[model samples]
Target: MNQDNRYVICMKWGSKYPAEYVNRLYNMVKRHLTLDFQMVCLTDDTTGINPDIKCYPIPELNLPANLPERGWKKLTTFKPELYDLKGTALFLDIDIVIVDNIDCFFTYNAKHEDSVVIIRDWKKPWRMVGNSSVYRFKIGQNTYPKLLTYFEQNFEKIRQEVRHEQAFLSNYLREHHHLEYWDSSWCVSFKYHCLQKIPLAYFIPPKKPSGAKIIVFHGEINPPDAITGGGGKWYRHVLPSEWIKAAWQ
Candidate 1:
């Protein structure tokens, strides 16, 4: 693939996340990537975003208007016709910190003809990949249709069996030989990499991994609230303030 044909993608909507988060990601990608690439934010609101970051309107999947809120809206990334970018693209959640160069993620080899490269969830059983906090894929491949079919055929079954898109994706790719595990150290779990409050909140942050490229904020805690440690909600309370501050700078 032409190295110039790469992109960094993220999705945004509603007020839960601020628009600056999207702009910050754009800055992170610009600082870390050495190749000719574009940073694309798929969003419903484009106001106040950095002008350099290209914005694509989020595509509407034809799911029922009253579909229960299962956080499955994120599955929209898998829509082929919706994303027309060529070659390989890396998708990052806006809540993450790009502490190191991400150019390598673009270069890692795929495991199979239809494989997607993602970090294996070490905390979960080896058979199950944890979350799609960060993943890379080729555009216009229609990966979403296969995913939708699984939900359609096993709608009730999946609702009872899985809580998130990652679980469904891991199962689908496992069956198709299209799931490749990224090197463990390349992507570190925030709970493990930062502070773990088992005994107390006194755990000092460890030295950043020598070659790790990304730090994912998967659940609850995120970069903004993590860096401040001031958000009152229970979900935002476990953040490692010092760690995120240093990582973003």
Candidate 2:
């Protein structure tokens, strides 16, 4: 209910994604978000990030170092009393590119105060699974704690059942009656929505999807890769997209 408490928070960790990713995300939010809110980054290191964005240490997930990284650390974002953050919190993955005004992300769900809004999984439309790259939730003593607590207690069983953290979260939130999805067009997937498919992908340059507000880059491709049109493998070649370079800054 406190509109002043609105925050756009993101996470960054390790050598895979540097501080620049967080910095770019902050710049994007500042450019597109006309709403009054704070910008935050939760990470192990904050070197090179701009000071305007509030930085917070990522809470420990308490998992063993020997385990495979299936993005389980993201669950820590749900820790009931996360630092001093309160009210509507938008959790964004560092790899995403904002292509249009995102003030709607906060206002579109203004009426559904209890709904946990996320982007619907591009691959699995039949099931209620959602892509966690972009999502909105209240930042206090809501039902958020249960997601992390349940995973901590049942990691062995959970890791086998779900492919990754987003999959587990999508199903759990749906079953708990807290799941809501953003409009499909607002958060379009770059791989599925923008790039030409297969054979055509080789000749045609990636086109920015019309009316897309936030272009999500998941799995093998990222913004850097989109600029060069190299997906790290021969089969995934995309013609360089000029629009990605324009928006990523």
Candidate 3:
């Protein structure tokens, strides 16, 4: 591995998000990151993805047939041999919008190279859960057999304890590694930080978050919804946000 190689990887296994999300992410990273890096996407379908971005098949988690899928596929990113990718990998969810310089994500903890860095969950701060929407870790490092083997053996027990993949991942890394977080302001949630309160939501268009490098659309309201003002719910009305149109592209 080249000492200078940095990687930004995103997952797009299902049809819930289109290829445009991957392309736009590449463009956003190209604009913001000063460092040289390879843009990679792991997807089930790569028909329309930009040729500049490398495409790899999403590794199989191989869960039981009766098991429910709650973002379990994302765990495969920790595969021991991830298509020859090594060194630091920053994983971004496809729906997230980059609005500022993101070079800090790779450089935040310069001394602690072994630490697993992630975004602190916006909703569950007290429990210290990490939202996997944005996280940086060394490829094929701590989590391969340590995280995967445990999950495979104790999937039943793990499922009973945590609802989703992020919770499972956060809990494991916290126990084993130096689980760090990006600055709270750098990875803001669009719905939490930008959307106005109920009645006011109708009057005001969604506001662009200040000091946010990546605006995360966690549960609802993705980039398209923000661009066209489709907040995806009846009560939450988002008037066409022009900044989203400009920024998401």
TM-score of each: 0.85, 0.94, 0.94
User: Which of the predicted structures, 2 or 3, would earn the higher lDDT when compared with the native?
Assistant: 2
The numbered model that scores best in lDDT is: 2
Error of 1 at 67 (Å): 4.1
Clash totals in order: 0, 0, 0
Please give, for residues 45-133, the per-residue lDDT of candidate 1 as tens digits.
Answer: 99998888888888775555676666676666676555566666788888888888877888787766678777788576556665687
User: In candidate 2, which residue ranges exceed 4 Å CA deviation?
Assistant: 1-4, 110-112
Residue-level lDDT tens digits of model 2 in 1-249? 463588999998888999989999999999999989899898899999999999999899866677877788787878888888778889999999998999999887434556789988889788778888999987865546577878888888888899899889887876764788898889998888888877888899888778899999887899988998787356666788999999998
Query: What is the full ranking by TM-score, best candidate first?
Result: 3, 2, 1
Candidate 1, residue 123: the lDDT equals 75
Error of 1 at 210 (Å): 4.2
Best by TM-score: 3
What ranges in model 1 sit over 4 Å off?
A: 1-4, 66-68, 142-145, 149-154, 196-200, 203-207, 230-243
Worst 10 residues of 1 by lDDT: 230-239
